[model samples]
Target: MAQKGLCWKEDEMGELVHTGTSSPDISVIRSLAMKHLPGSYDTMDVAFFAEGSFNKLYCVSSPHLPQDYLIRVALPVDPFFNRESEVATLAYIRKYTSIPVPKVLAFCSSSESELGFEWILMEKIGGVPLSDIWDEMPVEAKESLPTEICGYLKSHQDLQFIKIGSLYFSLVRERVGTRDFGETSAYPSLPIVVLSHLHINS
Candidate 1:
C-alpha cells in the first residue's frame, strides 16, 4: 500500500509542523452514525463539537439514544497508524488501570472508509475542561489536583511492555507487521510492537 503524505502548516515558531485539517462530510456522518446510533436518521442531529491538532469531533444525538456519542474524524497526518495506535492505547488503559477514558463503540482506521476519513465512534465523556474552571477552583481543590493527576500517571507507570513501540490489536499488527509478532506483558488483548509498520491498510 502507498503511504499517505503528511499535512503541514506553519507553527507559531515559524517552523513547519504536521497538522490535521480533516473536514468529514456531515451527510455521510449522519448516515454512519445512524448505523450505530439509536433512533431514525431523519430525527438524529449531528453537530460539530470540537477540534484538536489531529482530529475534528462531532456530536451525534437522537431522542432514542441513551446518551450522546462523539464522532472523531482524523486528518491524513499519519493516516492509519495514529488512529489504530490510539484505539489500542485506550483499550490498554481501560483494561489495565482505573483511569477513566472514553469507551469506543465503533471505529474505522482506514481513510478509504465510506466516510472518506478515519473515524472513531465513542461514548461521550461528560465533564468540563479543567482550564474552564481552574481559576475558580478553591485553593484546597487546587492543592489536591496534583495528587489526583499523579495517581493516573502512576497507573501508567505500573504497566510494563517488553518492546518500546506503540501497542496495537493483534489483528492490526498482523496485517501491518512484516511477520507474526510476540505478545507483551499479558495486556488484556493480544500484544503488538515497534514503529511505522504498525499501521493497518484496512
Candidate 2:
C-alpha cells in the first residue's frame, strides 16, 4: 500500500489569532439576540455558563421564548473544526430524523459573523453534562443512557454516504452540501480516513 498525505503548514492561519478562553464582545451577542431572536429577548439575559479549551458556552434566557438558550462561541481558531458543518448536521438530523439535537435558533460562521468567530445559538439542552454528574448517577441511569444513545445512533445507520466530508447546507442550492474539505484533530482528511493508501471513508 502506498501512503499519501496532504502538506499542511503549521502557520496556515495567516493573521487570525486564536483567543482561547477569551470571550467575544458581550454587546455583539446582545445585538445578535435582538436582531434574529427579537421574539425571544427584548433584553437579553446573558450569563457566563462555562468555558472549555476551544469554546465558551453561555446561558441566555428570554421572557418570550418557552425555554432558555445556549450560545456556544468557538474561541480557538482550529482549521479542523467547522461550525457551519456542525450547524448543518444538527439542522438536518432535527429536520429529517427522530434524533434529538438542539435546534439551531441562529448561527454565524467565522467569515459571516460580527463577533469575528463562529457561534451558534441553540435551544438549551436539559440536564447536566454526563462528565459532571456521571459519578453520582445510579447504575440504572448509567446503563439506560448508553442504551438510549445507541438507539439514537442506530436510527441513522441506514443512511449512507459515498464520500466523507464536513456536512453543510447551502441555502442557494437548498440541499445538503458535503464537498468542502478541512482539517480536524481526529480525522486528517476532513471527515474521511486515509491510512497507508487504505481508504476508510466515513
Candidate 3:
C-alpha cells in the first residue's frame, strides 16, 4: 500500500528529522519478489500491513507463490547496521533455538538500491497481534501465556557466546572495522555499548 507521509524522527536536539523513505516504488519491489522468491509474477498484491517506530511493513501476495510474504523497510535511523544486526540476530536465534521467528527470504542491508531503503522480504507469520486477543483468552490460556513467553526467554539465555555484543554476519563484522570490537571469528559481534548508544541517541 502507498503511504502519503515521510517517516520522521526527533533528534537529540528535539528537531524533527525525516528518517525514512516514503512510499517505495512498487514496480521495483515486485521485481525483487520475482528475483528472490519462488514462481514468476508480472505483478503482485501489496497492501499496507503495519507501521512501527522503526519500520513500515507491507503484505505481499501473489498468484504464483504458495503463501503471502511480508516486507519490512527500515526508517534509516541507524542505516545499514540496524538492518544488518536484526537479520543476523534472527539467524543466530534460529541457529541456536526453536523460536519461530519469521524466515528471511531476501534482504538488502544498504539503501543504495532502486527502492532507496533497506528492506527484508520474509515469510509472513500469520496471527492477530497478541494485544488484540489477550482480553478474550480463557483463564487457563492466560495463565499459561507467561510460561510460554518465559520459555522463549530461557531459550535465549541458553545460547552461549564468547562476547557481549550485537550479532552480525561474519563478513559484515569484519568489514565494520579491523580492531576487535568484540569477536568476529565464529559469529561476528560488535560491542553491545555501540548498539546501546546508537539506540539511545537515535
Candidate 4:
C-alpha cells in the first residue's frame, strides 16, 4: 500500500500526533481522513471553544468541501470511562430516534503502527451547543428546554438494552466504588413529566 502522506509524529508532550499535526495520538483521525477525504488534505484547525477534559476536538474544513466537521480525539484515559461502549450506545440510539445528533461518519481504533489514540469523525451540527446558549436564554426558553430533553429521553426509553452497557454506571463504579445496579426502577416514571403532552394529544 502506498503511503498517503499520512503519518504519525510526536507532539511536545511526546505523545503521538497524527498527520504531522501537533495533536496527541491522532493516528485514528489520520486514517479516517485519508480514507474518506483522500487527496483533499487540509490543515487541522483546533477549536478553542471546547470545555471538556476527555477529548480534544477540532473543527476541520477544506476548500473542497462545502461544510465544516468535527473530529473528536479520544484521550488515552478513556477506556476506564467505557469509550467503546458509549459509541456503541450512541449508534444504537441513532437507529431509532429522529432527535438531532452528530452523524458518525467514521471511527478508527489505535494501534502501534498508527497514532496510538482512538478518534471519531462526526458531521457538525448547525446550531450552537446547549452549553453555549443556555445561560443567555429566557426563563420560558429554559422551561421548554427540559421538555425537549425529556422528549428525547422518552423516545429512547423503550430501548432498554443498549448494545453497549451503561457509561454512567461505569463512572459510578470508578469514582464511587459501586457495582452496576442494573436499570433503576424510577427511570420509566421520569419521562412522564415530558411525555405528558403526548398523552394529552393521544
Whole-model lDDT values for every prediction: 0.77, 0.62, 0.73, 0.54
Question: Model 2 segments beyond 4 Å from truth?
Answer: 1-22, 38-42, 76-81, 130-146, 172-202
lDDT for 5 in candidate 4 is 26
Root-mean-square deviation of candidate 3: 5.5
Clashing pairs in 4: 16-25
The TM-score of candidate 2 is 0.64
lDDT of 2 by residue, 1-202 (tens): 1111112233555543333434477888777767766464557788888887667888887677678888888743432236755776786567556787898888876534687667888888787667999899999999898888887888677445445554554441222223333333343433332111121346
Please report how far candidate 1 places residue 4 from its true position, in Å.
8.6
- The sequence of per-residue lDDT tens digits that candidate 1 reaches over residues 1-202 is 2223336768899988874344678989988989876446567789999888777899998877888999998877666677888898888788888899998988999988888888999999888989999999999999998999899999989988665566667777655554444666464344545434443548
User: Best by TM-score, which number?
Assistant: 1
Candidate no. 1 TM-score:
0.79
Local error of candidate 2 at 23, Å? 2.9
Candidate order (lDDT)? 1, 3, 2, 4
- In model 2, pairs of residues that clash are 80-183
Cα misplacement distance, residue 202 of candidate 1 (Å): 19
Q: Rank the candidates by TM-score, best first.
A: 1, 3, 2, 4
Q: After superposition, how far is residue 104 of candidate 2 from its true place, in Å?
A: 0.7
- Cα lDDT over the full model 4: 0.54
lDDT agreement of model 1 with the native: 0.77
Worst 10 residues of 4 by lDDT: 192-201
Worst 10 residues of 2 by lDDT: 1-10
For all candidates, the clash counts are 0, 1, 0, 1
